[model samples]
Target chain A: DAGVTQSPTHLIKTRGQQVTLRCSPKSGHDTVSWYQQALGQGPQFIFQYYEEEERQRGNFPDRFSGHQFPNYSSELNVNALLLGDSALYLCASSFTVQGYQETQYFGPGTRLLVL
Target chain B: AQTVTQSQPEMSVQEAETVTLSCTYDTSESNYYLFWYKQPPSRQMILVIRQEAYKQQNATENRFSVNFQKAAKSFSLKISDSQLGDTAMYFCALKRSSRALNFGKGTSLLVTP
Candidate 1:
């Protein structure tokens, strides 16, 4: 069984530009969540997608958006990227078993560098 | 809003020895979950162990274990027989029902020979 997989192991974008990172969740998983890990810091949740709709979101601004396809794959889009947007974007997948307390397995993450 | 804190920014331990990392979180929810994730140089987030709020026995996985103090709002991770592979950035996270996980700044652990 394959674990969560992310595309474009690394990406570089300029300021004011937009970028999209892709993720294929683990097999048998339906929920996808995105997180941002800055240098020397832990990951901060961006948002979660369930049933092709955003289920939960963190304090991120509107510029950060995501979508979940029918196949349970996800894409995270960041518009008007700033220098601070440079960080490791991580994707985690989980199967919502009992409503909560599900174990989330993560991907290798896409390193985004906003130049 | 809930907040998780890892006071120790860095920790070191000799190979085959033991080391403890501290964490504390602020939350008002009665039912929730706590987790420890390890991120190595490769940058993959690996779940080390987890604990449910209602459970009192604590959670353990191999050489990794958690000391959960509900009243004190403290969750600390202990790694026994530390090896070089154990070196990584350890993050403490808290998640309430149907909520996103709130993670601490993380503590970097380095195991040396």
Candidate 2:
């Protein structure tokens, strides 16, 4: 079975520009989550989508948004990109059984660089 | 709010040897989860092992094992008989009851042959 797959392995954008990253969740998974991993730091949760609705969000600002399709594919959108926004964006998916105990499977991630 | 910490930035071990990476976290939730993920040069985040907060026994998978101390909020990973293929950046993460994770800065492990 194919694991989670992300599009555009690497991306480059300029300040004040907007960018979108895509992710396909693992087969048989329903929930999708996005994370940002800065150099020398661990991944931080950005937001999570379940049933095509934004169920929960992290500490990120309104500039970061996401969407989950019926097929469980997800897209992350960043508006007004900043140089600080350059990081490895990871997508994780998990099966929500009985509403608890989540084991997330992660994608390779999309490397974003804002110049 | 929860936070994970990995004090060691980098560590090196000889092939066939054993090494341990340290991690600690702060959380008030009674039930949660902890995980260790390995990111190799390929940059794929692979799940190494996980420990549930309520489980008293540590979680183990093959040569990978964890020493989980719930009271102290400590979760350390031990890799036995390390191999050159074990080189990677290891991250410690915490999943609260709310299901979002808080992660540590990560420790880079290098296995020399």
Highest DockQ, which number?
A: 1
User: Cα deviation in Å at residue B1, candidate 2?
Assistant: 7.9
Candidate 2 chain A weakest ten by summed lDDT: A93-102
Q: lDDT tens digits, residues B7-104, model 2?
A: 99999999999999999999889989999999998999999999999999999999999999998989999999999999999999999986777889
Instruction: State the fnat of model 2.
Output: 0.77
Question: For candidate 2, what is the DockQ?
Answer: 0.77
Taking all chains together, each candidate's TM-score versus the true structure is 0.97, 0.97
Q: What is the TM-score of chain B alone in each candidate?
A: 0.97, 0.97
Per-residue lDDT of candidate 1, residues B14-80 (tens digit): 9999999999999899989999999998889999999999999989999999999999999999999
Model 1, span A1-115: residue lDDT tens: 9999999999999999999999999999999999999999889999999889999998899999999999999999999999999999999999887666278889999999988
Q: Quote the RMSD, in angstroms, for model 2.
A: 1.1
Q: Candidate 2 residues A22-101, lDDT tens each?
A: 99999999999999999878999999999899988988999999999889899999999999999999999998877763
Cα RMSD for predicted model 1: 1.1
Q: Candidate 1 iRMS, in Å?
A: 1.3
